[model samples]
Target chain A: MDTHDAKKPLPRLTPDNRAFWEGCREHKILLPWCQYCDRPHWPPGPVCPYCFGDDLTWKQSSGRGVISSWVVVHKAWLPAFAADIPYNAVQVELEEGIRLTGNVVGASNKTLRVGLPVEVVFDDVTPEATLPRFKPR
Target chain B: MRDDVAIVGIGQSEFGRYLPISQLGLGAKALQAALTDAQLERKDIDGLSLHMGWPLGADYDRMAEVYGLEVDYVHQSWTHGRFVTSSLQHAVMAVACGMAEVVACITAISFTRELSILGGPGDPEGMREQGATHGENPVYGLTSPAVGAAFALQRYMALYGATSAQLAAVPIALRKHALLSPYAVMKQPLTLEDHQSSRMVVDPLHLFDCSLITDGAAVVLLTSAERARSMPNVPVYVAGMQGVRSGRSEFIFAPPGLGINQQPASPTTPRERDLAVYGRAGIGREAIQGFYTYDAFSPLVLFALERFGFCGPGEGASWVQGGRIELGGELPVNTSGGLLSEAHVCGWNSICEMVRQLRGMAGPRQIAGAEALQWGTCWGDSVIMRR
Candidate 1:
């Protein structure tokens, strides 16, 4: 049983996600836009699933939304998450109408509300990694 | 499709947190087990279907080499949790459509290195570009199926007030059944308190709520039902099959609050649509003997039970609150321990369990020698219940 929860601890950047990370580095949340449907997407994508369009563009976000759902982590299956035992994990529905799941910093399950207003912030868990985390507006 | 394809044999590798087995080795063991169970020589097989799981990239080629057959026909269907039933359906359809006489379908995981915390390992360039559904969900808390299932579990609570004890029943009855299942992992007595105390990967879905990223494999052998009767193992017939999908556009949706109770209903879900997986057998829910479902998430078992007509909508809470899904319950499900107690050999274990029950070899998990078995795939893509 090589259950090595050993942390190699590098956020390797791949080609498809490169531009998205670049946007994050510049403090701009971005999504891929398909020329076919003509709407910006939360997650960067190549083919527009709705219209089957391949042409896409990355667009910036206002980074605003209401908490559609949330849960408090009292436990974790891996050692990477073991230290942050009591954290608030949330599914925030952005103003652009994209719903995403992430951690809400400076809060716990007891304080999370279904409709709490939130804004995005970046936390570099590792030097090579800068992840988007949310907080109370 | 061939109206008479039946599962004549089934087998699985020992499952657990870790094991010293190659994906190919585990697959060969399971394939050999099925061959022995069916009492057929390896030369009898011609068709094959393999789920391209998160194992070694060369699974299909390696399996073909070890099994000593130049596979005549093969199917590669892959996806998340509900993939087990879906994979079996592909194998059956291959046989049904006149592809081959004997077909073996399997899934295997051998290395801890192959497992990905967010999603199964895939071509990075091909994967990250997958859009809102796969892309953003992973970046958020849903990187793992357990986290993805937590989203649904939270909704299950808001809708039916489903309790932790009720949810624990999914793993508890399973572990009890695993006492009889030689291949299952996590079989020790685990209480709701134990589940409550287990580390939570995502709230609502705990460690136990998540299926193991195990190292093992399961294989099933199928042939025309008439041929199966002459064979030694109990003959189980292929009954019905169907597949369902929700929020097909962008993966994320607020699940519009139709009545504005200001809340979302339990997802209408792929498994919820009464698509006819068991309709071909002409057996109703009450007459159906055994049920095997994909349990990538703990809440999915309950979803299948409620959606598949074991109980009415929103009655999942009362359905498995105690020992309802165990051996003596009105319907016994996941007798081979499902994905929770069993290893996560993708969804292959569920197919093997279904065959085991139909053959009356389920031992401790056996449900009074059932004549029929119903198995749901990829939530509800297909339900192949047979007698």
Candidate 2:
């Protein structure tokens, strides 16, 4: 998993989401929090999605959550992932109450289930891109 | 605008796989058939409500120019199944408002030709700055739209203790209807065992659970109710309409509060707001003799039933069993096979089937005394048509 393949798709970086990606590169999970709403939102945007307020800040998360939903890809829709057939992708409900999509590492696809406790582990797949996967805690 | 506009004509080209015909070519055949069915000339069409566009189907402007349709009013949306109800709603609105004389809701697809875009690298939807609407995160190898449905269904089964065998009833019923449909791409009857043994594309979603990647086109014509009287076919009045819902609680592939994407975990039955289409249509859900939906995946049919209050949350899997949604069941859905067994004309095929059912023209798959039918999706948009 350490070998970086050019074939794997990378998340498109934008001005609004740059910090979250940058935080990931530093091995930390950052979430956008609104000062007015006093809560964090997902897929970070400039304005607070909850209150539509401009007062927003970044905060570190515990990188801990429970699996809310999960799926195993049996088809190689992407050729780069052909070797990883039957691989699992999951939606983890983070401690901050926002969900993020990632893979569950160091676990068998058969054992994955909803409400399973997991913590994030950064995978520095490429020199520039580090994806955050999860493992059973 | 209730009953002010009606679908006077419905037509479609032969549905199949890897057809050599171009998208525009298929569209022309369907358009010609629609014009002939309505006993109207090509020049009568003054508006175009296009649901399919670039990369999958012809653009509105290209369709207008190639088909020689000189229209004034036009509505176009991106190529997605969620837009089918909205696209037809736009046509009804255009005709009711006197914006156009007759609007043609055009949808033509060549999925076999554009196979790469479905989930392959050719699809850039997952790489969008905001993110793909259907939970497509290619970075995690969740590249296809089916994965989104799988994600929702996986959670749904976990929450409700549903099983794969219960979900198989969906494709099995639809395949039964396809056997009676001349236009359906799949002519064979499907069994629960066949569904169980089918290869898995995404976990909890067998290959049969997904829609056909075949090629086809369907065209529908709408005009004012006053003008419909002169048409050759029976007018299927656009009795009621509602738009697609969106918010923090709604997920594109899941019913409200099923907890997919960022949706909250509190699952509830259909609220009053969810049943607005029934009131708008001047009928209750009981009056809806037949049902239709964007069955891109088998799970959508279940979610739609739940979204429309046909059943409570987590009950769709069990509710659809025992010939419940079949042709002569409590409420038949997608009598013309739907996207699952019928060709994926982006759900427009079901729309055509609706018009046919209301007209008493659906030969074998017709619902007895069918008066009202619904075209709703899991996304919460709907259009109800009545005879």
Candidate 3:
């Protein structure tokens, strides 16, 4: 197993969201599917935002989305990302109708555009976490 | 509630970095100055309304205790420019309801240690039991408010063909105004070329487009119109004021679900809450002579210009192209250099400028024959002051 020092901020694994992180380790994208509303959402929460129902479950994602908007960070505010200056942070709208935030790995700042088609590519940055990244499809 | 409340005194601390003093010290200095300016002592103040953005280590009760003044009425709004006007409204209502005779509205921000208002690793809201998320963006490398604002700017440019030159003019004009302002932090004059050639913190936004992070505080003294008339400074009446929070729940960086589309569907459209502020004040758009919009980012100026009906949507870039927003222009905007060059104390700096313009105390930067001055945040907080 290959791991690096936790230089950047990392997500803590919790009971309600452990499945999503665990699934990421296996190269599977997971989102919360509410039993009450039958709708999936991102940045998993305790209950359905719309219905507020406790009946919720995990669902696999289709792994496709569009670039709703994006920004190229030329300056790094944190020491961890100093080496990665000039990276792209993008807002991706999944085919499942959920919007997730990630960076597009294979695109330049000049090339990125709104509504650009993108597909998810998981990066096993550390042994404990796998970061989701996007690339032009 | 309209003609009943008037701002009689205004005070501000030096807006650059002040070390060894917490936000409390800065706020107390401004409050004391305001009390003296109003020709009243701390004991005369019975109401306190404060807008101190989050990570606030103290509250209204704490401030009252520190000053040894007992305020009969108190209200607080936490986090950013949107709350400053809301805090002012609370003071107006407090005086109208007889809760307090003299109310003081204070706002302050300290970045001496170089604190970032944008979510950081220390943010409680950014922390989760499983992992830390960067506010709504939730991305590894992107952590500043500029990132979210850049996305909106890109959409605006795509839709209206607004160019960088048009956006650069906003900062350039404001910087020129700052030269005349003795309290301004950025004393150097700025040009359109300097704005265009500056480093890009985020795409479609330059380093100059963002605001100055400094340690400063501003205070406004509000009282009944009858009492204000006796004060030393001329009374600037609060003619019409209103605040509206967006009901849209979907995050800006997040995509809406299939049935749920991202609200405020157009990033640049003037919101209903904006129009309501004008209607509430019973003043038509043409009556406003001076203007100030929250300039946390430069593109926001364009959003506000159109939102307040100063110009049609997509015409803001051209509206400010000539010297229209300068001191001699028909309608002067941000005569105090605003957040870009003046110093960003949330909205306090702008509010103080509006007060000065209406009182004819702005000196060289003063807009002559100014009848009314209006100030608002991009998020819908608004206030109109009449001479």
Better of 1 and 3 by lDDT: 3
The order by descending DockQ is: 2, 3, 1
DockQ in order: 0.24, 0.91, 0.44
Lowest lDDT block of 10, candidate 1 chain B: B252-261
DockQ of 3: 0.44
Better of 2 and 3 by lDDT: 2
Clashing pairs in 3: A11-B130, A11-B131, A12-B130, A12-B131, A13-B130
Best by TM-score: 2
Error of 3 at B315 (Å): 3.9
Model 2 gets an lDDT of 0.91
Q: Which 10-residue window in model 1 chain A sums to the lowest lDDT?
A: A1-10
TM-score for each of the candidates: 0.81, 0.99, 0.90
RMSD of each: 5.3, 0.9, 3.5
List ranges where model 1 is wrong by over 4 Å.
A1-41, A47-62, A72-86, A121-132, B52-58, B77-80, B111-127, B131-143, B244-274, B309-314
Task: Please report how far candidate 1 places residue B149 from its true position, in Å.
Answer: 1.7
Docking class of 1: acceptable
lDDT of 2 by residue, A1-137 (tens): 33577898987899888989899999999999999988999878889987899899999999999999999999989988888788899999999999999989899988999999999999888889999999999
Residue-by-residue lDDT tens digits, candidate 2, B44-78 = 99999998986567778888888888999999986
**Segments of candidate 3 deviating more than 4 angstroms:** A1-5, A12-22, A34-38, A41-57, B18-20, B53-57, B114-125, B128-139, B249-273
